[model samples]
Target: MGKPMVLFLCTGNSARSQMAEAFLRQHAGNKYDAHSAGLNPQGVHPLTIQVMKETGIDISGHQSKSLNQYLGKTSPKWVIFGCEKAEESCPHVWPFSLQSESWNLEDPVDFTGDELEQLMKFRFVRDQIEARILDWITENRIDSETEN
Candidate 1:
């Protein structure tokens, strides 16, 4: 199968970016490969883990990565900015990617509410990203099965 790639970037990989990473990786599966990085690295958030666990996706091993690590380290077909902070703070020269998009999503870290409310937002964002990514994949790529 051909490699289809995507990157999710944010100020901190703890919440928004990580959730996007975990969600896309899980939902996209073999259709696309996804990764997340932060402008300034920080450990993954506990709430991020808690929220993802509800959907049976484990992100416990996902490390908060600095954008520097990915700057010249990997080639992406797509690069996505998960928050406005990442877009504004991104390096002067973006590492080349075939497709780039910014979702400008809200960071759930500042979300103050009961546990249920926060989880609901997490799930909502996760599902939204999955839908968007899958739509992009479908529109831009042809599945291996259809190549013949």
Candidate 2:
């Protein structure tokens, strides 16, 4: 059997979902296939690229995708919503998903501030997502090379 698929869904594929996907792939690529999409499909934010780069994960090539892309094609074992809005918008019965849940991370795109502050907000959200990914990996006992 192939690695289980994990999908991160959010209002915009711009930040939170993007971060979660990359972190999971980096931390536990051996255990799961990570993918992400958004309800609205906003293009990935510039800050999202910049922040992920800070962690040595280059998401510059990642594109924002719509939920429709996966609706009929893939079966994700786990579907995680990065924000409340996406969770609320998601259908109660997600097809082929064994588990579904929300993380409710703040949308850094919604944070208002100057350039530096805006970057900081993105970094903060990125860190939060990474931490959650690490925790989830540990809780599930996913033994990846990086965890050794």
Candidate 3:
């Protein structure tokens, strides 16, 4: 069987969800496939690319996509919303999803600050997403191993 799939969603696919997708791919790509989309597609943010690059993961090529891209084509094992807007906007029932959750992560785009401070905010969110992904990977490791 193929690895399980994880989809991260947010209002804009520019930051939080993007970061989560890359982190999951980096931390558990062998055990799961990580993908992300937006309720309203906004091109990946420049700061998002910069912050991720700081961690050595280049998401410069990652495109912000609409959830429609996956609605009928893919059924993720987990559908995770990175923000409250997405959680509220998405359908309550993902018929094919095994689980659904909202992370309610802070949107770095909403943070108002100088360049360095803004970058710090982006990094902060990025790190938070990474930590959560790591914990999730650990929590699911046993299940993933058994399934494989």
Candidate 4:
């Protein structure tokens, strides 16, 4: 058996995709491997780091990346679209090995104003995404037969 591969995607690869990547990695343990990318890469957002660290998930080392980087790579078993733009921009050329889903997360990059408000929203979205991933993983709970 092999590790299940999961890919999280977004337009900017800065916030939502990054969060999904961390959540899956932390929650899935050794049962899976995960990565994240975007249609148009930008540096990882600073706030993304702050909020995840609140829950002790350090994503500060993650850098934003483009989807083209994975074009020729092996397709993942699970591909999750974490942003609207990435959902719209995903190429239809992926091989049949992929099972995909979209969370349609609101990009926190658009969030502005007070620092307190921003942190609140960031944590809110992060927790929501984390809960969703936890539910999905639990619903598909793996047995020993599914282990590598």
Worst 10 residues of 3 by lDDT: 87-96
* Stretches > 4 Å off in candidate 1: 143-148
Model 1, 30-148: lDDT tens digits are 66677888988888988788878877988888889988887777787778898887887773435566667788887777788998898788677766766776676667666423532
How many residue pairs collide in each prediction?
Answer: 0, 0, 0, 0
Instruction: Give lDDT for model 4.
Output: 0.82
lDDT of 1 at 28: 58
Kindly list the per-residue Cα lDDT of model 4 for residues 43-148, writing each as its tens digit: 8888889999988999888899888888878677778888767777774636575577878888888888698888888888899889988987886566412655
* lDDT values for all models: 0.76, 0.89, 0.91, 0.82
Which RMSD values do the candidates have, in order?
Answer: 2.8, 3.1, 1.0, 1.8
Question: Where does candidate 4 stray beyond 4 Å?
Answer: 91-93, 143-147
**Which pairs of residues collide in candidate 1?**
none
Cα RMSD for predicted model 2: 3.1
| Model 4 quality (TM-score) | 0.91
Ranking by TM-score: 3, 2, 4, 1
Q: Report residue 104 deviation for candidate 4 (angstroms).
A: 0.5
Best by lDDT: 3
Model 3 stretches with alpha carbons more than 4 Å out = none
Candidate 2 stretches greater than 4 Å from native: 93-95, 142-148
Q: Kindly report which residue pairs in candidate 2 clash with one another.
A: none
The estimated TM-scores of all candidates read 0.82, 0.93, 0.96, 0.91
lDDT leaderboard ranking:
3, 2, 4, 1
